[model samples]
Target: MTVTERVRPGVDAGRLMEHITALAAIGATPDGGVTRLAFSPEDVEGRAYVARLMAEAGLAVRVDPAGNLIGTRPGIDPGAATLVLGSHIDTVVNGGAYDGAYGVLAAIEVARTLAERGVRLACGLAVVAFCDEEGGHGTMGMLGAHGFAGALPPGIAKVLDERGVPVGDLLAAVGGDAERLPEAAWAPGDIAAYLELHVEQGDVLERRGVPIGVVESIAGRVNVSVTVEGVAGHAGTTSMDHRSDALVAAARVVLAVRAIAAEEGVVLRATTGTCSVGPGMWNVIPGRVRLGVEFRDVSADRLDAALARLAGAAGEIAAADGVTVTVEPGARTTPVACDPRLRDLVAGAARERGLDCHHLPSGAGHDAQIVARVAPIGMIFVPSEGGISHAPGEHTAPHHLVWGADVLLSAVLRFDEAPVARG
Candidate 1:
């Protein structure tokens, strides 16, 4: 199972850490997480810094219409499609350094290493820094990948954050012209394959005492908003049976959702993120209640069954309480499985390096999921310290970072030698 390829000196861990540490300082939050919103001033400056580094590594860089940064290293064959290495540059509110940043940084390191040795492969390498993967304000994550995949445009026309700034307005503020946003998308034939390196984002690897993880599939997500309405009544004198408690209905809805998720199996997960009861909560029986429910799993059929059960339970509970329920389907995205060929390549590379590796499913969503729709996609993962992420305390040892990068390099080399697969 070992992929015996010529191994060059591994990337310098010191240099890799320096890049992440320095970029983290730009939008450092009070708690140590980063807050660089997409198409914001901080993002503009951060991207500029990355572009400069890419240039230093001998990459020909370009900024597309959607404000995505792409750096290309041309191979001997100019007619061949390009191998893409990319991830989002945006971060969640107070997110950690190793989240999206690690993928982009690792690509940069790989390009640098290749250039230092003057190694030229069959296909060109394109390092990409996708925009707005975090969806901090617009609720539109993976905007850049979606655009490139032809599913949607990267510049959304009329999305406003809490402060009233339109999504298009935000793009303009960061030197992105909305009129030219259509040029951001890529044709289906342009990409050879896509590879992403990211943090595990969970405690699985650390808990299992493994150094690296090769993701098998990315989980699909279903988000729903449920509102329960009932008659408002005075808490002082209204009898318990006479009063229609909206809060009680909402509570039951939450528990029912949890039950469906548990019954669905280990791959299925559910969460009731928000809940509210109207008026002063001290005494009055609430007249209205609102909540959001989200479900995720690797199997589409299983997810559908879970949602059906959840809907049934919610309706029954609301009917018993004399309350009406309204359900709004928020978002439905299919789970993406990584390219099996590329997955095997990564596993072989890890074994060649004498590293302990296993295949694991990613519970969190990623930019690679969008890319999977258009090209063969693969992801390499490193352990998250204490399985912590999206926080300042999130970390992975320097050695582990280098180890993952080494595996990535070997995998890329093996992929370069393989035949182009066309279906």
Candidate 2:
């Protein structure tokens, strides 16, 4: 189908941009960034605004026990499995405007366009705004989606935030029943497919002059926490040859991380985003060092191999430096491949619109990765200018945003006609 032929009559570009602008104001920062951390007051207010928008768009809205916002529009066949579309709304501290909010607001726009035209399909449509995707309060990320997928760990209710408030209490504060979080899990077959529209968060599409990206896979991520213990001494008293410096060992590990990732392949990403030295003093030899290491790759085998190398390297470094090195693995999420049929549908949507589209892999983690456990999933990416994300500079041109929404609307319409299998 050509773009002109499938174009919905009333897909309002202005209204869509308006929604983005309005939501961007909730946690608006003086630096032109946003700070709506999960479960924060700004997050709650933002979700409330979304719920209101969902209601005004004529959908029945509800907040799940895990705090995910769900808005459902019944189909002609009410018993059919649902077509779910959405992205999270919570942002990283000082995050960009478009990262999570665009997908959500665009999903609403799709529903709004359909409702305005009185179009109902064979399958139901649902828009969801998952909670805590950015993992504030030191909790594992994608909490809401994890719960909905029946993947949330037990004792999650006891997990505390920075203020020592339990997750259950926080959920309550946001109008959710954390005690019933497990009840929020949807049966594996309930949803026919899941789709998300998000910024590319990279320069790939923009550099290629493409407006759309059909994601091939979402990369798997493994986080490792490392601590090195060594003797602390006065810098002047401890000669370089006699000193066992934890900071020096940690630095070697960091360098090894970079080298290992580079040796693995272009697809592998390794980072040490956080590092700290205890008793940090200009005149003192560091006694202890802590580092957070993260590895991401589309191939599980490659990630595993890289992880093994990292552990081995850490051990060797510790032995050479005369320090005790401990590597504690944290969250590990497997790579997710988008359903082939849905990928084609997304490409078709772009083709019909005469928009250039590229097939790519997402280096960043997303809620769609978690939701894929329950349903066949697909993702669409609009270009992010200058490859900027998680910062105030993140942006996609208004026209690009409109085009992305149009493509999403087209794909959703196509899915409604002949939905894919849930598995």
lDDT of each: 0.82, 0.90
* lDDT per residue (tens digit) for residues 123-213 in model 2: 9889999988998877778989998799999898898877798999878877779779878898887898999999999999999999999
lDDT of 1: 0.82
Provide the lowest-lDDT 10-residue window in model 2: 1-10
User: Which digits, one per residue and each the tens of the lDDT, describe model 1 over residues 1-423?
Assistant: 233535556676789889988888878899878888787677888888889888987899887655578899877788888899979778877888888888898888888887886778779899999878888676478877776676664347566777777767766665555677667767767888899999898878888888779999999988988999988888999998797888988998988888777764633688899887797477788999999899899888877877777778878987899998887778998998898888888888788788888789998999899988788889999999888887778888888888898888887788888834634
How close to the true structure is residue 256 of candidate 1, measured as C-alpha lDDT? Answer: 82
Pairs of residues clashing in candidate 2: 3-352
- Candidate that scores best on TM-score: 2
Tell me the lDDT of model 1 at 369: 93
Q: Work out how many backbone clashes candidate 1 has.
A: 0
